[model samples]
Target chain A: MKSLLQNLARWLVPVCFIAFSFSEEPYQLKLAMSWGSDFPVFSESPKRMAERVAKMSNGRLTIDVIGSEEHGRPLDVFDMVRNGEYDLGHSASYYWKGKVPNTLFFTTMPFGMLPLEQYAWLEHGGGQALMDEVYQPLGLLSLPGGNSGSQMGGWFQKRIKNTESLNGLKMRVPGFAGEVLSELGVVPTNIPATDLYEAMSRNVIQAAEFVGPSTDFNLKLHLAAQFYYTGWHEPGAELQFLINDEVYQSLPADLQAILKAAMRASAYDTYVHSVDVSAQAWADMRRQFPTIRVKDFPDEVMSELRRVNERKLVEFADDNDQARRIIESQLGYQAMMRNWTLLSDYSYLESIGR
Target chain B: MKSLLQNLARWLVPVCFIAFSFSEEPYQLKLAMSWGSDFPVFSESPKRMAERVAKMSNGRLTIDVIGSEEHGRPLDVFDMVRNGEYDLGHSASYYWKGKVPNTLFFTTMPFGMLPLEQYAWLEHGGGQALMDEVYQPLGLLSLPGGNSGSQMGGWFQKRIKNTESLNGLKMRVPGFAGEVLSELGVVPTNIPATDLYEAMSRNVIQAAEFVGPSTDFNLKLHLAAQFYYTGWHEPGAELQFLINDEVYQSLPADLQAILKAAMRASAYDTYVHSVDVSAQAWADMRRQFPTIRVKDFPDEVMSELRRVNERKLVEFADDNDQARRIIESQLGYQAMMRNWTLLSDYSYLESIGR
Candidate 1:
């Protein structure tokens, strides 16, 4: 009788749980990415996250990823996820700044913190909560997808010696950086990514800023330009993962934990991968293109850019309460953290003569 | 009869699988940590990793962590895990250099690559394979546990202006860095963590290097020494997680996946957490202790230290084939990556004057 009861109990447990708990039926999610199918590191991050989630969950949850080439709306990821047309999105938050003003702060800003510093702000210094405040109202959730590390300033056809060199210069820069460049008398022109190389080659634009060496090398920018400038704008540009609140809330507790863990691991993996890719690409570029000279904008030009950036930020914050709050928070955190950065990485690099 | 057979099939499937698979039985592993129970970030990392594993596995796999205070063998974690006395260990790889010569390269080196650079090597540039060559023979598996960011050089009672200033200076610094300092005429002493504060206060040791501000502030070294110097040694010190290969192989595939994902997430979290903690602590120290001045060793002294460090590395590599291979790999990878670092983060910092 005792042996029979034990067998009966084991059988009853699996039967009841399997039938009622909904664990047997797999939950499928659709993810849309802003990057095209062939995009290297950018497209790989979301796919890696999805793969990890599936394995970790033992196939209980699966995510089907569709890149921009299939979706035909690279920039519509935000709306697709928000409206439940897609369950998740992989894109940059700043890409939505035109639709939502506060979205810009989540990505890298001109003269902003580096990758680790920005991560500190996001994880510990109230940046995440502020981000939640903005996204929660739209019934959306956002997670840091990955970082591109620090981007280079741009590729210039000629050396930028002073502020005068920037005046009347036609450059294909984008977004907030374009605005800042326009303030300095440079004509910031918007050109399709495909046309960027031709524009520069034909003297339609004298300079152009794409990503760092890893992605920019694909555009053959080094062949058209002799000077590669150091980065100021888009230092540690972070991409984001967007999820519909309803879709996320409907998942089981364990699945939620699994998804978050997978996202976190993949996000970090992408950053480390980017560092390796960029290092290798930069090395290759230097070896192949001996004429490409790395340059820094003159101190006077850098100072003028900083001054203009600060003024533009003030004007941006003056109108919106949420924008003001975010700007103030970022400024305060940057002030506090910058001292540590100066003492740690900056000092170490200086001592080594990098 | 057909309907009855269909119903019976469903019930029998769950019963047979659940009973035969033994999925209900839990796998519990014990982890021994090198840090004391009260140690802040170091102790917290393994605990967080264990918690995530438990949640993600839905309690099928659990880890019981015992710190050094409980185990009474802080430096014996590598042996303990290897002998299967503990299934896992949380410690730094360099701690085992005396027992295994190749273990030294797995951790940070003096004037070596920074955290991200080292991580890039481990993840992409053939580092993990080399590490496996050393550890796999011992029936051990190692994973990156956490990073301490950039460590400050040390706290000094007097300014170190040149090589002469280092002569006859008694300092508490340990391991390979101490060996380098000894060559420069500085007396390197090892003091217990509990006794370092008193040793500095009584002038038993005129200077000491613990960690950066996050951990160092806890020792209150700033109160005894007013001069804080920037780092040259252990730029980005990474810790390790060691697992018994036999124990790891005993786990189910899904559980194995869960454990790896959890460890990866927690390790990155600890690094991001350390940046925030160090920044906050450094800010607090500045506000509370106005007289604590941060200093950098003069260029002559820095150059001398570098020369000695390079010589010592050559001596270290001369005897062991594995050590030579790791050293060569690190040097080559650093040469390739440093250019990217300079063009990216270093230039960005200089442009902002940080």
Candidate 2:
């Protein structure tokens, strides 16, 4: 009897193995983001990304995404994801300045570097290594996302008469920009997502900043402010992607390549959205919100601010070695890119003006 | 003299106004993030949010914090902020899945969904609206930034003879219960930082998973097996902050409240970093790496996969609206989430898993 049972077990295992080997498991994936469908990040990028990745993987893996509002509030995303509540999430960095100060360098700085320069530093410099160092402690890895090519100055409710006007002014700003504003005597503030519209509409703040015209138009800034500013401070900005450390390490190398390709698609989408939508959004705002006023910053104002920006850099370098290193690297790159820009993009614009 | 002065006056009038108004130019803002920061989303409970917000706001309205790795790779952050870049950026969102496919949801998904129920529903429900809705044509808004909760099952080296055979497999694992491996097949692959020494030894990997102690000790698997298996769809994920659009609309009344006292401070230094270095990071992974083996999956493995999981709601609903609602909501959310996930995250995971 025992011999017969053993023989049966061996055959059963082998038979099952042969049958299962020929089949594949149904696969599915999940993605989480803090923003809603209206947000350009996911609408323009993630959706397309899902389709491309699926095709590349031959349907072996499938994905599903949940927006921030659908999952949790914007702030809850990090914890939810870390806790394994969501497979993926889309978010920002400054929101967590309390935990890692160094992270600020990657996000943005007051009079820091421009988008192109920042990208150079991140890809070639030790930025990725440094970032991993911080995240490793938490079992996470990171990747690059999208980039907004420079941004316009924020909207204004009142015009300035002099530098003195900046004193005691309440402003909504983040990162290094806030520090720069502080130097000019402006008080900076930070608020959550839901409350922004209410605060701006209710007069809780004197000045505020969001993104570019496309985004601003969506938020209906035209109804609240009178003046639109130019883009001199933030020439460009990049987005990012994060991963759980253990999970990332487990992925096959080829899969990693596919992921990179998908991300590139998303980035392209964001870029195109910004370019295609900004002009139209602005035009619409002009027609719908006639009260809105658009204008550029005076060259003199830009020049003086640029001087202050230099001073701020010196101050930052004085305290931290990393800051000094970053500044030096950034400036060096800027010098190199200066000629590149002048010869490439700038020349075309100049000729058009003529 | 009057005629000559009139000519000078015309040009001087506009130049003087620009120069004088330069002081009043809208303040620039930049938001940043790091994986380790303690933020409003992932750090302390909501009860503690007020105090932190108060400190940063100094009695004014506070900036909202969605600090974590919700956006993209921590390294790419600088790019997002530099170009007027992103006014704010979170830590890392699946390391740029938006730009990379397979990697997109890996930051958070794998098994998908855990941490706290409250957070899970938030993401699966309308919470995404709070962040995504606010960021549109412009390139900005807030995002998830906190998380460190549930995780994936981990990888294994050897094929399982049965569900119980998950034992004795070699595997690489981190966080939570990496300590419990004695009863399981795992040999445990404990590699050190950077070097991941034990894993480099490549002794096993027959079957492994360390996130749960069962896989940790059993997989001592990194040393023993050739196959690695795990259920960890998502290990500890995090939220990220996104801020490009809001930073642009600096003039809206409600927008101004977006940046203020304690909240801003909470988002930056205090809240952002703490979450990354949670207690889980303090555990060691060295003891398990010595004797793991690797393994592979056999044919006809598990049955009732897609059909079972896909119809899970119908089976579990039990005629209750609430039950149906839960399943329906999950399905609905998954439907939306899948559109993008399939295109990017799913394919990436599969490509690598293969």
Top-lDDT structure, candidate number: 1
lDDT of 2: 0.47
Tens digits of per-residue lDDT for model 2, A1-354: 655655554545543433332333424556676578567643546666666656655554456767666766766655565666665555555444456544555554434444433544565445566666655676655554555544666766787555675678777766566666677788889876446666777888777777776577667666677876655455555555555555545555544544554654455345434443554455566567777655554544555566777897787679777667756766664454443233222222222221
User: Which stretches of model 1 miss by more than 4 angstroms?
Assistant: A1-23, B1-23
Clashing pairs in 1: none
For model 1 chain A, the run of ten residues with the poorest summed lDDT: A15-24
Taken over the whole model, the C-alpha lDDT of each candidate is 0.90, 0.47
- Candidate 2 versus the native: TM-score? 0.45
- Clash count for candidate 2 is 303
lDDT of 1 by residue, B143-251 (tens): 9998988899999999987899999999999999898999889999999877888999999999999899998888989988999999999888889999999999999
Q: Please give the lDDT score at residue B182 for candidate 1.
A: 92
- Candidate 1, residue A187: CA error in Å? 1.5
